[model samples]
Target: MELNYVISITDRDQIQELAALFQSLELNMGLAMLGKGTATSEQLSIYGLSNTEKAIVSTVADGESARQLFRAAKRKLFMDIPGNGIMLTVPIKSVGGGRTLAYLTGNKTPAGGAPDMNFEHELIIAVLNEGYSDAVMDAARTAGAGGGTVLHARGTGTKQAEKFFGVSLAEEKDILYIVATAQQKAAIMTAINKTTGAGTKAGAICFSLPVSQVIGLRKMDDN
Candidate 1:
């Protein structure tokens, strides 16, 4: 089945509520990270941001479930209120390998013949050892990536990840987010992998998600 990534950036105190909401919706796979909003004093005042500390919640859901979750979040989390938060979804091209895919999809693949390719933009996400966001960004920039957002996170492992990736995983993590055109996604990911991949202290894993819409980013001609 096709998947979409639902991301919510909201007040730190509201994270638990959203986590419970996701659980109620049966979207078992989720992650939360700590971050600080990058608004100036004037901007914060304009947006009514009393606090800058933020929690970023991410999860995977089917299209229908994603729509339901977004609607529920807007009402329950007060996302319509200024400075409350923002929610967005990015379509996933594919997820997991053979056996892993089976486990993730419960052995039932979507009836679509094969995944289609009509998206123009992608969100490149890189999760790495803590404090390596700058390094990742530098690498990405060299490969045509522009500015990105960084979030402080912690990783939990059910299995020994060191055995699988040949590098010890760090509980403290940093997630770097870069949005680029589809043509630049591969190059950006390749740069990140080379400098921060398993062999490095960063132990980074990079992936991309299709972006179906963009609002704030400026048009190329405008730049």
Candidate 2:
């Protein structure tokens, strides 16, 4: 079966409802993180989003179940309506081992196949030192990125991480998520790396993921 990593971002007030929705869908292994939207006042107005705390929820599911979850979220939570939330799925290429795969997939048989690559947009994720989100967002904006979400996080094994990445890393981190068009991904990533990457105060590490499906960004698309 094809596996997908599903991510949902919504207002903090809606987290409980979203969690119950996930439970009804059997997406039990999900995690929720507190985050804040990075949109400016004007941008927030344009997107019909209020300046409120956000929740970032993620989970793994088979392709079919992922689709079902998306549909249910749209119908039950009005996720398709602007200001409700956004949901997206990224294809999972592989997992660790048999038992690991079974646990993630709920014991479904594993299958190997080429990932779908015909997506028009991708999700760019950046990990940076805490309090450096402003610098990262500034760089990203220069490369045509509109807005992003910032999640506060704590890191482990920093000593080893510093040796591997050749840069000092703090335990406190900020994970920034930017969804941009495929055409904009490279430039945004390059800009971020040049301005905030290793050796810089931000010391950011950036990467991209294929977004097989997404919703609640009609305003972005219209722009």
Candidate 3:
């Protein structure tokens, strides 16, 4: 009875293949966008990644379905391979308004229960001034982050944001999506704070969402 948000990021060429997999799992309602990874050359070499071009696929899935897709991704997409890709799911606190929620759940009313915050994985989302994704990723790497996907996005409520911060909140914003273990979340957030926090020109705002499940992110054995 729980909803989960599933996100998959992989090489651009694999978009269709992965999408097909999602369709096979009935995760048909989704969107795909192009992005570029911000991994350093050394990092790329370490992960066996050859290109920076990426495709980010996202969908809203029920909890059980999300788990099924996660396992399929590891087996079909080679997600367990160091640099193949990463997928994660965050519990959805609530779905939609009354009717919309019912439709999504096939007439079942949303439990609307209090959200549970305890989790072992976190999704680090950082919104930064344009062109600063590399800087943010640099700090992230120093704090144990493997890599991140950068998406071109524009900010809204510029006036309110600028007034509150007393600085220009550029409409053009770059969003960095980084997933890390719960134990490493604090360090990664700290690193981002020092480099692009409110005091800096990047005007970065960072936060974390408790992830219920993560796939393709486990460290590979040396076997």
Candidate 4:
């Protein structure tokens, strides 16, 4: 059995509906977080998006179930339509312990074999000081990134982080998620690090995760 971490980003108003959809799929252990779209006013206008508030829902599922959830979301929520939302699956490479693995997989037989790492798209996650998202996105765009979703967050281990980095660390943070083609991932990450890295005022750290599948990116693809 192969496992994947599925994430859906949509309007905050759709949280209830999205939760219901997840229930129908028996993905009851899902979690939801509040976020905002990073689209500039012009980009939002071009895409017909008015509301920037978003809800990010995540859950774990087997490979087949993950595909089913994507199909259902497209049909019922019109996620395939531009500006509706986006969904992506990151292949789960391993679990920490047997009990935790069983809990996540509903006690299914322990998964075997390594997950396929070959992928066309990657999820670029950048953690930055709260107000630096705009600057970071600017750098990312210059490297061929299309757009990103921003989630407001708080940092822990602030004292330790500051001690290690030798810089005052801000408690408030912003997490930016950018989906980009594998060919452009390196350039995008490099641009971000060079411009707003930990050494800079943005104090940003960027990384990438292999995405097995992605949906609701037709608009981006069209552009």
Candidate 5:
């Protein structure tokens, strides 16, 4: 089974509705909301963080259940809505346990495909300004970053981003998420800063996590 990791773009005020939407789909609200996305400054617009009002991230079931949720979302909410985010899915191979899988998918009937509970590498999560994913990715390559996922996004905030390192700001942005080894994090971040530091549009903030488990990545193996 596969999972749809829907990063629903919207504003903080709209979180309730988004939450309700997820609840309706019986999906898990993974890290559902940004820690401090309400304020423009906290929104991190160097990468166009200002263009995004807020985002609601969730993982939903696949197969019939996934299809049902998408149909419902399209019929009920994804129309004429300005700034509504995009929905995409990544396949999960297996889970740590039935309970863990249920929590991750919000109890949606599993097609028996959750993320594998065992893996050799760590998964890094980098949240940064948009429009600079290219630069970030280049840096990651230099830093021994195995590879990464790039998602285009609009960072919110018109007033908060007056001058980041003495530069005017834009209202939209992009985000590059990379999963790298524990040893390579430093090089990747350094490479990204070289391009986006004070003069470029891709300035970013990066962080990482140890992968408890993962699945479906023959491509990752070649790396």
Candidate 6:
């Protein structure tokens, strides 16, 4: 079985509407995260750059479900409201992380059995440092990745430092996402870790998910 995730990045004002749109299409909202501009403001202020606000909404779903939601959004929302939003889907391999399996799919139903995220196919996931956009792209490209989305994010639970390491960590961050194949996953991660993780301070992180099924994107051409 392949698992797939539909991730949406938008401003605070659009979250509710986006949620409703997804819900209408039968995809359950799994997790939601905020994007504070504090760090961006600080970093930009240092160089006199302006700041912008954003948020991320991630949903777990099957390929058919994802396609339906995409169509709904496009027809209902027009999807080009000038910074209103962007939505995409990535394939995941497994869901053996936590109690999440049962939690995410209330029916305890498999992807095929219950539209509850049976994965339906296989895909890759890459986690990397906040700022290494270029490195992420380069590495993904090496593994047949044509493009990925950039998500503004922040680290949580920082009450630790300010003590042990004496290192004041900036909570603001950025996460780049690339969805490729089970075959391309490993190479992309290795390229990212080797170049961004080792050579730079981006502190790159990488991982993958098996995708069960997919919709649209006859153009992405997974190499």
Q: Which candidate is the best by TM-score?
A: 4
* Order of models, best TM-score first: 4, 3, 2, 1, 6, 5
Cα lDDT tens digits for candidate 5, 97-196 = 9887678766767454455534344554554565556566666666665444455555554454555343333545555555444556667777776765
Q: State the C-alpha lDDT per candidate.
A: 0.72, 0.86, 0.81, 0.86, 0.52, 0.57
For model 4, the superposed segments whose C-alpha errors exceed 4 Å read 158-160, 167-170, 219-223
Candidate 3 off by > 4 Å: 106-115, 167-170, 218-223
Rate residue 66 of model 3 by lDDT.
79
Model 4, residue 102: displacement in angstroms?
Answer: 2.6
Q: Cα-based RMSD of the predictions, in order?
A: 6.5, 2.4, 2.7, 2.0, 12.2, 8.3
Q: List the candidates' TM-scores in order.
A: 0.56, 0.88, 0.88, 0.91, 0.43, 0.53
Model 3: per-residue Cα lDDT over 95-126, one tens digit each: 55877665554565455564577998899999
Cα-lDDT of candidate 1 = 0.72
Q: Which ranges in model 6 have alpha carbons more than 4 Å from their true place? A: 1-5, 8-17, 25-56, 60-125, 156-171, 216-223
Ranking by lDDT: 4, 2, 3, 1, 6, 5
Residue clash pairs of candidate 2: none
- How would you encode candidate 6's per-residue C-alpha lDDT over 115-216 as one tens digit per residue? 343343334444444666766677667666644556665666365653553322355556665545555666777777777653356656566654444333
lDDT of 6 at 26: 60
lDDT of 6 at 21: 76
Which should have the higher TM-score, number 3 or number 6? 3
Candidate with the larger TM-score of 3 and 5: 3
- Model 4 C-alpha lDDT versus the unseen true structure: 0.86
> Candidate 6: global Cα-lDDT?
0.57
lDDT at 12, model 5: 59
